[model samples]
Target: MDIRVKFLGGAKSVTGSKYLITVNDFHVLIDCGLFQGLKQLRLRNWDDLPVNPEKIDCIVLTHAHIDHSGYIPLLYKNGFGGKVHCTEPTLELADILLTDSAKLQEEEAEFANRKGYSKHNPAKPLYTVRDAIEALNILEAHPFDLTFRIHNQIEVRFFHAGHILGAASIELIIYSSQGIKRMVFSGDLGPMHNPLHFAPVKPPNADVLFMESTYGARRHKDVDLEKELRQLILESDKKGGCILIPAFSVGRTQLVLYYIWKIFQNMKSRPVYIDSPMAISVTHLYKSFSNYHRLESDSEFGHHIFDAPFVHYVTEQSKSKVLNTIKDRAIIISASGMATGGRVLHHLFHRLPREQDIVLFTGFLPEGTRGRDIANGEKLVKIFGEEVMINAKIHVLDGFSAHADQDELVEWSGHISEPPKMTFLIHGEKEQAEVLRERLIGRGWNVTIPDYLETFTLFDHV
Candidate 1:
């Protein structure tokens, strides 16, 4: 049989991207993204395996985003023993994100059980923090684009896809007695003109391809991110209110932090508070990677930025709760970027009010999320079963979104050597993925949008 492919994750709904590539006796998984959205998406993470995890020989991570990497710990929990390979930056970020995800999941379950809000008496976490740490123990770091053998028959390499700090597009070279074939997996692609990092690097050529459809169908508004964020910050403060930023801690938060540093350059006013407990932990990781250059601006600018006395980090639970009491208006950054869950929910429930506060969004807000409501101009946001008036200002820095737009995706593909036999679109909503698929189809590219668990065979090219 030809090489086989399975759509384990990231398909019509955009979350959970797991694909199996098997040639001869060698097998490898391209990505093990966690399905994140509503209960169904989260439950997918707990579902039994369609294929035995032990049978898989290796895993290639596209980047360190939670959806792409969150399930790794669960894989470990299930006794998958293969090495997890990624770029050095991805490895570092994955360590931070996966562990944090486990903690959050466990904490959420515990809270649910305590509050009697869960259907299950236990309401256990999908995977524990220890599981995440175990998954981390198996990671093998490699440099980008350097072909390495995961097995006797499979050779793989990674290229920077530029969606965020350590994001990449993956390429695989499958060697067989008949010939050598290639497949490419486009992770979340960063913008062509993104301010945070370099543009995404495209594939060198492949017989089969998998591209992301996160922003495939739409174009972003052309505006200066710094100016836009500054306006939001200024107006939010005009009424002496706090600014609540529900940001993806990995890419979006760092980008906002950079722009906030930029905002502080011309104007000075109230202080800013980083209230996500996980975000505080992630800040150290960001510093270690230099992903947020402005935070490093002290060194880049030849002075200490956080050294300033006003930028406060709310690490402890007590400290986070106290933000509600701080009479002064401040900028508070929280996690669970979509406001689906996380400390941001607490902030929204307690702090959001008429024009006295604001919710500044940086990433795509999934449906049925508080962030989505705010972005869609919902006047009232229901949090923890209570509707809170969105009196504070609302804004979306779409440009700061980590994923690359359509034009950028096409530009990144230029580096590929030969067209793949197929290019699958994953990790995007139906509309977004379709937008990207149509664009590629117009160019005569053989692309397919796989559904959850759909399988395919990778036939060898003549």
Candidate 2:
């Protein structure tokens, strides 16, 4: 029997995570995610998978982040009808993200066609909201730590990865004619000191390991993120200008809101508003899965994570548009963290020219993104075909990132009982992966920085 693994998407880049694992007569895909950032990478979303999706038996999602689980709907649309195994919170959050993704694609396509900016005669969405719902229906929810059988020859388990609400590291025990071998897939591992979720759990013994290196190249700077946020709010208020936060609706948005609610629960001047409908819905999901969070869901502080004296949720387009007209010193949090797309762009267009306002980023902004460009001090940016001056103060609060840093990743890897036979680093850019490869090598572990569509045989031939 031959057992092989393929690095589909998240090999040399930080986005679009898809891993295909093939065992004798059975095929399993892990982490069907969409690519973001550069136009070339984003274009890969429209490209067909290396293998036919119809032939795949099942998909195992690591988390609910768009880069880790966003491509499932597209896979389903391509004829994959098998079960998508994930934690309950992951399943629920996937529903929110995938649905929102489909809607966003449709909206972008419609806008492109109307504006005649697209090369195609009529721009088309990759998938529809109906397709997203179809994919969401097939998710099979499982709990962490419990071993379950996905096939007669394959057993699997989920460990807390701590990146998001239900992020997990997957352990697969594959039975072959030679013997049983374990393969561990570390999804996006969160920081050890994450305020919202617990640290990533240690992996059990394994023969092969696939790990993420999103922050492999550098250590996160020591900064008081909450304090910075509070200070920014106060400064913006003092200047009578709004503070705009472009956050990923899933983990970052919720975390930012949690910190805001905690820091300014008693403050009356900083009126906070969640302007993205998708983020508002995702925030509600955090309440539903109270046990998944580190804090007590029902406690006075915990129960009000999303509540502030003047906090508002702008669910309708009309209400969101009204925010652009308000010159008050309010805090607005919107989605599409990198400012790739979404209501956040509208806010950026309206507020970027205002010298007193501040544009704050609470998460990673990949290269080539508008957020990165502005963060890098680009003076002029095109929003809706109009050049907008970046007069607003650009601030990056790196302490809010969810991914584990270099030292923390090394610490996590040290938890393995023994060094695995081999480790393949994925989910990071080239320099980051190479830097981590060198670090892991120093610790006496063999590591490979895989390329996109690379393949490796996991089992020895007889």
lDDT by residue for model 1 over 95-140, one digit each (tens)? 8888888888898888888777778898899888888887899998
TM-score: model 2 vs. ground truth: 0.97
What is the per-residue lDDT of model 2 for residues 1-462, given as tens digits with 9 covering 90 to 100?
A: 788998889998999999999987689999999999889998999898999988899999899888888899889888997999999999888888889999999998999899988898799998999999988888999999999998998999999999999999999998867788999999999999987888999888878889999999989999887788888888888778888999988878888877887777556546788989888887888788888877676676584767656679999998899999889778899988899889998999999999889999887788879989999999999887679999888998989999999898888888888899999999999999899999999989989999899999888651
Q: What is the C-alpha RMSD of each candidate to the true structure, in Å?
A: 2.4, 1.4
Local distance difference test, candidate 1:
0.76
Per-candidate TM vs. native? 0.93, 0.97
Clashes of each: 19, 0
Off by over 4 Å in 1: 290-309, 379-382, 385-389, 460-462
Q: What is the lDDT of residue 200 in candidate 1?
A: 70
Error of 1 at 202 (Å): 3.2
Q: Where does candidate 2 have its weakest 10-residue lDDT segment?
A: 262-271
Question: Lowest lDDT 10-mer window, candidate 1?
Answer: 294-303
